[model samples]
Target: MPYSRHLGPLTPPAWHRPWFRYIDAVPGAEGAPPAPDPAQSAQTPPADPPAEPVDYKAKYEEAIGHSRQWEQRAKDNKAKADKFDAAEQEKLSEIEKANLRIADAEKASAAVAAELLQLKAANANGITKDERALLTGTTEDELKAQVAAILKLRAPSTASAQDAGITGGGSAAPTSRAKTLAEAVAARINKK
Candidate 1:
């Protein structure tokens, strides 16, 4: 006559239901080999295969960044070289032009000097011609007399010691003096 038990009217507890369902659902899986519990397995913990090695993404990123920096430096160097080359070319062209101008100036100076020399010579010749023409206006007899007087004044005396013993054939003619005068006259006339 304690409190009447209600076991007959109550449904089964839910705690045991899942266990029963697992046991019933996996009877073939359990029969195969107890499923080899992970904790009890002797597979040597799989040795972790050397931990798959780290990716080192940061180090690779740093190396790539350095490479990019070096590339930029190379580009800058090339640009500088290009600029220098262009400037050098311009300087060279300027130098070439200067040389050409200098050459041209030298040629012009030479031409001018030649022309000046030619003009001076022409003026000299013109003056000489004018002097000669002015001298022609004098009396012919007077000019002849002056030339004869100059020749007589310049002639060696026949009694001079150098001419005294110099005698020609038979008549002792003044052949040597005449021949010398003739040669001088011929030379002077040829010079004209």
Candidate 2:
């Protein structure tokens, strides 16, 4: 026989053999059987049959009814909102009227308070209510001056005492005479 060189083994090693065999195998090799037909597979259920034609008219009518219901609801909500707005306006008007009334009452109260203060001031100055009512002066100072003039006019005059013949009452007879005249004038005032 002729000499020949054996560079490698005829069959590959065990670890390399499986990889080579897998690559060499056919798509449907005997070791791995063919996949089951989709129609006959137990895992896949049959597809549903063709559905009947849609009833577009009935569907459109139902959609229209729903739309109408929504529109009516919107209208009702708007009506309620309008009613609430009207009520609020009425309440605001009422509040405004109440505010006006309050303002008027405050003005009246201020006037009464001023009058009361004037009356108190007059009373503090020993002016009686009846005397103040008879007095006619626009201001307190004028009223006070008028009251002073009236008091001065009502006071007994020295000329009246001299006319009564009541000179200085150093003597008992003149004193008695002065006392009598004074009593007579007091009695006359009381009678009036």
Candidate 3:
């Protein structure tokens, strides 16, 4: 009788719902497929979430490729920077050397001037005779020779306009050969 609560033993699960209850109650209907037992499905648990797909080969290759590129670029940049730094250091060294040369020349010129002044002061008649004589030394003659040599070394070359007869600060167009030779000889003596 309990099973007869339905029109028959075989009925669709959908027909057992309230919305479809009218279908079962229809007067001359035979029956439908039997509903599945709920206990059969209850014993099993729900499935786990789907796993993410992996591409190990692709990921490994990409990581290695990027690392190599980074290492190469790092080496290249370091080499370039070192090259420029070395060049810069060389340039700085050259400039320092030039500056040292200029400083030495200036100091030499100043010392020559100071020695000339001392010689002049020593020879001055205004000083006491005893103090003036006490200033006697080879310093005055030696400094005079050095100054003359420096002046001769710094003089204009033989090819200057003065020697080329080019007018304006130059020798006259008609200057005698003897005059030129005399000038050269005089420069040589002064330089010695």
Candidate 4:
């Protein structure tokens, strides 16, 4: 593009512009040192003086003190971290124990509910108390099935001798010798 003098002047000058403000940049510029003469250089000593000794021990001790302070801070941070970790571990163990207790309670509740259901089903089926203890099932249908099985097992023995037209078994004479009360007690004691 062609140069535009008007636009260039409108733009703000950057920090690196106006180079003439700096001193002694180029050789042979204004304020430049005069050329040295060989005759004056051989006679005069160098311009700068010798540097003094650096305080090495004082600097070394300060550095060591700063490093020790940082080390102590690191140790304090580690101790706090250890304490937090222990607290977290304790909370985790407590949570685990509580979860175990909840699981056990849930298991026991399920077992009791199942037993109650079985007993209710047995009672509804008109089962005897002794037979009800034998009933075992997790669901109503299974309990009903168990009750039916028990009833089926004892179906034949429900009738008495009167219903079968059979008699004389109740009044039969005893074949064994009759024992007195004292002899019965003595026998019972001996058996025990």
lDDT of 1 by residue, 54-121 (tens): 77998899999999999999999999999998887687877797998999999999777655553444
> What pairs collide in candidate 2?
none
Every model's TM-score? 0.22, 0.29, 0.25, 0.34
- RMSD per prediction, one decimal? 41.3, 35.4, 30.5, 29.4
After superposing candidate 1, which stretches have Cα over 4 Å from the reference? 1-55, 94-192
Highest TM-score: give the candidate number: 4
- Give each model's whole-structure lDDT: 0.56, 0.64, 0.60, 0.68
Q: For residues 97-169, write the lDDT of model 3, one tens digit per residue.
A: 7998999999999877765665675454234444333332235554344344333434555565555556556
Best-to-worst lDDT order: 4, 2, 3, 1
lDDT of candidate 1 vs native?
Answer: 0.56
37 Cα displacement, candidate 2 (Å): 4.5
Cα RMSD, model 3: 30.5
Candidate 4 local Cα displacement, residue 64, angstroms: 67
Return the candidate ranking by TM-score, descending: 4, 2, 3, 1
Give the lowest summed-lDDT range of ten residues in model 1: 130-139
**Residue lDDT tens for model 4, 1-192:** 454455653433446476535444454565555667889999998898899999999999999999999999999999999999888767787779799899999999999999889878877888898877656667787666667666665465444564333663553433212223234334335534
